[model samples]
Target: MTATTAPAPSRLQRVAALAGAETRLLLRNRTAVVNSLLLPLFLVAFVPVAGLGGDGPLGPRLVVTAFAVTLVFLTYHNLVTTYVARREELVLQRMRSGELTPGEVLLGTAVPTLLVTLAQVVLVLAGTAVIGEWSAPTDVVLPLVALLGGMLLMTLLAAASTSFTRTAESAQITTLPLVVLASITSGIVVPLTAFPEQVAQVVRLTPIEPVVELARLGLAGQTWDGRSVDWAAAPQPLLVLAAWIAVAAAVAPRVFRWAPRR
Candidate 1:
């Protein structure tokens, strides 16, 4: 007789399976579904409520939608809820003991939400192309990277938050700080430009500010106002975003909980 061990699943296979299961779970949870979709939709709807910006909205609209979409689906609402839910249910602890590595566990969680976000980003871009005064980003690379970085940072922060979250129900309150900050100071709810120069500079220091700036810079001058975007202003924001990501990365492994807090 010979003993045999099963081969580990490839990262792609593991992630895909986890994502499929997670998607179904997300669909079943009415609360998660609404928070993921409706909350972001509310922000999208509020774009008009904010009134036309200095530009009719092509500019402000693009930035707001991009930031809000990422914030809602990627981090604040979706990931936090899922993390706490999984932890409370012992789903995360079970995954840890299985073939799914820790990285696979987290990646699997983010991918489904990432797919949802990808769809929204494309839809908004298409809308801009059709009705917007300017169609494309001034520099695609910076904005694309920044938005991606925002997703990664937000995802990391969501996992780190689970350290303090005792249950799925408490996630609603736990996620509020990031949600409120992004809504107020991160340039999603109101463009930093509307703030005074002093205030704008201070606001830019917020966690999500660089994320919004990336979208703003990328979408530059595509607004109804037809303002000109300065592409030269990419480095500082890149550094700011990178720094926040570094901090989150440092905090994540330390703060991440494998068992429910008693």
Candidate 2:
């Protein structure tokens, strides 16, 4: 009998392989690319043209919020749904048997989506700067914090949502609630500042609120308050996001299926 041997790749190598494959697959899907990238650009362009008027601080805020929504819904949420579907189809199960670990799988899957979001943010910022005459950010750290937090939150939210999704096709319908809520109340279509004080207060408690506020403040070269950068003002949103992340991380490992529901 001949002896058989195999080489195990390092963790980093496995992650890189998975990430590269996922990124290529994502790019090949024309519809997904368009929905993830072009749709948001269209909204960014159309909203202002439809009398939203990019003339002041609110204009840049709206643009950034819209861009962020697109990043969350089209890329983050969609990727989660797709990942769950793939897992249920036994794709993830087989991959797990290879060099990739669960953590590697999740992180690798998110890398491409995060890159797409970054590109979208750049496009939106450029468009707003040109059309709305918006200034570049003053305190870039604030918005970077928001973006990082938002990406992490969205990934966790996706994992949580996948637990409820029985099939790949069902993911489309299942993710609608978050999509709608984030679109309206997250300051995408309208500024939270425009809402009544009580309503704004309530909205500010949501996960997306702080992100939008931070992005707006960052773009305007302003701090949380007129005094200085108060990271405390962002606590509620960050807490909400962190709670969601904890829930998803805890629940997904328990409930996520590696084979088809049937």
Candidate 3:
């Protein structure tokens, strides 16, 4: 008997195939696209152009907060609804028939989201540069750590959030805790400077604050607004973000659901 063998797809090909399908689905899901991309961009574009903060090009801190919020919208908020919807529809369960592992499925799902987040970051940087004389990052490593950490933490949290979320519609309510906290307390919509000193001190410990602060610190020591901040204060926030990431990672896998609760 003649041997017949077909070429097997590589690992990257498999993930790419999954991502292609996911991208198509995301495109059709206009609601998800609007929530993740269009709205976040609107806020970022609105801040400085709307003159919300006066004639200045907006402070580095404010810029940082805006970008951090975009990341959360794209990575965390988007994934929560997507995962829940897929699980409820049994799409995730159906994928089990493939030659892929659970980890591969999740990783594949994230590729498009990650690419979109990277583009958002580039837009944030370019937008800041156009608005002001943005400086090169003071500490390259820390900013990278902050972005990567924030993404990882949010990923785990998204998966974990699905455990509590029962339907695609309810995701709006379940995700409100994080979205509200970031917008109100974590300096996304409002800056720390707006808060009273004592309140700001406590708010610094909030989940998204460190990532936002780290983003600010990544900019030059002296910003276009002639604002000078202490780079030496980086350690504390770094520790806070790292601690949260650890907690989320450890808890996510244990709590994440692969199927609908009912």
Candidate 4:
């Protein structure tokens, strides 16, 4: 007798199942929980005290910096640890043996962290709107592109970083260079304008630079020189982000390891 073949799970079903499992795993890691969720809020609280640069009220700039910090800690840093831990545990290797494709495995693993980053950004924006008296973004599309593109790039970066991370504990060290560089250069705490012309020009080429520029342009509606912008101003930062994404996407597949390092 011929046996009937069960229909394969749809992409959504597959990703959702993987994401749900990842969520549960993420919840169990208290350090990751606090760092990814609570740490960003704590950092955002200091934006007013830190005094963001520019000609506008602090609300829009706060939103911009908050997005930067959130993507750094919540998405990039957390995923670095997650990838390392899963690799050390053979979780990635096992996932590859299943019905999941490589892209599915990576996206599923990142979904939990990405969702947390999104929630934290929303919370920060809400708090800023109420307390800082902020208004809606002048151009919503730029901010969305920044956040989504940042998440995708950060996820790819995390996976690529795992090539050097020997253990979950070492992820902290492996991730520090980018974390520190991005925090300082990505216009999170310091505006790119604070640097000299040549320095700022170099910083603009960094992976995180475009995300910050897009955030500022979208939320504050102003460029570094305090000039208001429209959709025309969006292309420069958008292209930078696209370039970074393409580089990361290309590098990740080449560097990403499905098995743990010896």
Candidate 5:
């Protein structure tokens, strides 16, 4: 009898194997553990003290704020550091020589971060439901869109950021500008309604703003001023998210470096 060659792994198996390895590496890094898991949870607890300080349902606003901040820390910030570290260590370049495609490599690296963010979001939402007495969302699709779109956008942005990020340590400094800006302008620290109308309009166009707005809209059935809006309004923020994702996706591949920056 002739021996047969082993079949290549399917795409799902390849991605899963990569993700499993990435998850183990993430757990081994204590700093990443604190930043990804502990810091976001701490921020959620701090939100009530900071206060939403405006009209509309407090529960949804609090929940959305938690969700947005979690995404920033777990998805965007973590991925930037991971990408930079992997590049500097030549892991990315070596992986490219294997059977995994570039997209598969990125998706695998991102899966752990995305899963962590999702878990934290669920915990925050559940806690808010019990403690804040929040109700079910009026429209689930918008918030779902917000979350899924935010993940894709943040992932692409993280990859794009690796273009300029010289070292893993520098990622902390480089990520701060966007993180601070998003916290302020994305209605996490303060509601968009707190800003003057002209300023809010311009701020709404910022990358993370649409995600926050959609979460607020879907969960509270209210806009910035706490006015009720219908399904027709969903398309606006959704389109904005798509636009940002498009821009980032286009730019990331063009600028991304497979090797560490010299």
Candidate 6:
């Protein structure tokens, strides 16, 4: 008798399988669902209510800020905590025993969250336009580019953050820096254009700056003349975001544990 072996699945096939499974699992979690959807809506609704103003440039700023907050809190932070939880629970370990690679696992885990984020973005834009009287994009391409880049950078940062997370519970605390910074400096809570020259310059160095700036420009045709909001003037944010992604990609595989470190 001749020995036989099955051919390995292609990367796309593996990713699809894993992503589908992950999506199903994510949907089952009520907390995840609420945070992913409800929180953004709350932010979008509440910010304007809190006297953030709804006319002129302030209107678009509030909308963009709300969107950024939603992205960071619901998508990025939530995913990290969930990833760590899954890892500690050995869900990742069991999956690794199969044909899935680490990249496949991460991609699979992130797919559902990404979908939720995209949906949230759409809803926010639509809702703001209807209720908050927001306008259309000034430069559609810029916002799309920023959002895509932001998602990529944030995903990698979440993966990197997981290295410090010993347990799912700890992930809540671990993700605070990004959450706080996103709110404070990413033009989410406050516009960079409104800041003093020195203060805005400092804020521009953060990872979330580029995305928020691009978003503002896209939504309201706003840009900074002092190199803070000017995308060309501050390439460091992009480079820093890229560097984090590269380092996370390099280190996550080696350090990532699929099960609790007993």
Q: Which candidate is the best by lDDT?
A: 4
What tens-digit string does per-residue lDDT give for candidate 2 at 139-165?
677778778877877776776677777
CA error at residue 202 for candidate 6, angstroms: 2.0
User: For model 4, what is the alpha-carbon lDDT of residue 29?
Assistant: 80
Candidate-wise lDDT, in order: 0.71, 0.68, 0.72, 0.83, 0.83, 0.72
lDDT (Cα, 0-100) at 195 in candidate 2: 80
Encode model 1's per-residue lDDT on 1-262: one tens digit a residue: 9999988778899989999998887688787566555544454455556652224445446654666556654555678777888888889999989989998998897787777676566655555555553455567776678668888888898989888888888888888887788777765557667789788888877788777666666666332123565566767778888998999999998999977877
Worst 10 residues of 2 by lDDT: 221-230
Instruction: List per-candidate RMSD values in Å.
Output: 3.4, 3.7, 3.6, 1.8, 1.8, 3.4
lDDT string, candidate 4, 121-235, tens digits: 8877777766856787788888899999999999999989988988889888999999899878886667777899899878887888888888888888887556788677778
Candidate 1 matches the true fold with a TM-score of: 0.84
Candidate 6 worst ten-residue window by lDDT: 225-234
Per-residue lDDT over 1-262 for candidate 5, one digit per residue giving the tens place of the 0 to 100 score: 9999999999999999999999998789888777656654565567677775235666676678866887787789889999999999999999989999999999998998988888777877766766765788888888898899999999999999998899999999989988998888887677777899999988888889889888888888877556788576677777888899999999999998999766
Question: Could you tell me which residue pairs clash in candidate 5?
Answer: none
Clashing pairs in 4: none
Off by over 4 Å in 3: 1-11, 30-37, 49-62, 130-134, 193-199, 220-231
Model 6 CA lDDT for position 233: 34
TM-score result, candidate 5? 0.93
Compose the digit string of candidate 3's lDDT tens values, residues 32-79: 666555654565667665544212335554456555766676788878
What TM-score would you give candidate 2 relative to the actual structure?
0.82
What would the TM-scores of all predictions be? Answer: 0.84, 0.82, 0.82, 0.93, 0.93, 0.83
lDDT of 6 at 122: 75
TM-score of 6: 0.83
Candidate 1 residue spans exceeding 4 A from truth? 1-7, 29-45, 52-60, 72-74, 130-134, 193-196, 221-227
Q: After best superposition, candidate 4 residue 68: deviation in angstroms?
A: 0.6
Cα-lDDT of candidate 4: 0.83
After TM-score superposition, the amount by which residue 76's alpha carbon in candidate 1 deviates from its true location, in angstroms, is: 2.2
